[model samples]
Target: MAMRKAKVQEQVVQAVARSNPGDRLVATVHGISGPAPQLTMAFGFIMLFVVKYYFVTVTERAVVVHRAAKFTGRPGDVVFNLPREQAHGIASEVRHGRQWNSFRLLFPGAAKPTRINVAAPWANDLGRLLSALGAAAPASG
Candidate 1:
């Protein structure tokens, strides 16, 4: 099982790399939307449903957010691209009230930060990757 998981991860990394030429992947976190019961009970069901929509790629120069239709049965979209220099930080929090674990990309110029409820299992890996990216982010002049 572990080997299979690793193989799948490799494939995912390769696919992302192919689509994002010139960018080197630093890390990836497979987001999970929680169990059926939790998803059904959550207010953000729609968003959570697509939590596993795509893998989040942290590259040397940018944070690429891609949405794949394979998970949603709808045409995918490139949600957004945040340059490392512009990202102020990455924040992860547990909303006890909602029983949600969320991750946000902070941008100084933006009024609101971009946020997502990170699937439970991938939380730690994602947090670490984002933290590394934050630390490595180019200083803004």
Candidate 2:
């Protein structure tokens, strides 16, 4: 199972590289649905086709968010472009009532950070991405 997951991550990295040439891939993760009840009001059947994606790629100068449809001629979006001399941070929080985890990119002078919800399996990838962001952030006294 671990090997399979690694293979999938590698594929995502490759895809990101192909989509955005010249950008380094720091980490990649498979998208999972948020912690929400699968059942709907109309019927007891679960909604299995949720369009949740968290394809994050952290590069040297910016953090890119590749949509699930990037392969279909769609361009990857830049979540945050690092400044030359500005401090940045990544934060994670778990909402008790919603029972979901949120990872955010805290940029310098930004009122609201860019946030994404991820399930448990993708938490490790989020942590690695956060570490990369921290490494790339500007030093502060």
Candidate 2: misplaced stretches above 4 Å? 1-4, 31-51, 69-100, 105-115, 135-141
Which residue pairs show backbone clashes in model 2? none
How does residue 127 of candidate 2 score in lDDT? 58
Q: For residues 33-98, write the lDDT of model 1, one tens digit per residue.
A: 334326544756464454444456677876766664433322135555677666445444323222
Per-model TM against the reference: 0.56, 0.51
Model 2 per-residue lDDT tens digits across residues 27-93 = 6544333334333213433443443344666665556555554123232454344432343444444
Rate residue 47 of model 1 by lDDT.
Answer: 48
Task: Rate residue 73 of model 1 by lDDT.
Answer: 28
Off by over 4 Å in 1: 1-8, 32-54, 70-76, 90-100, 106-111, 135-141
Candidate 2 C-alpha error for residue 89, in Å: 4.6
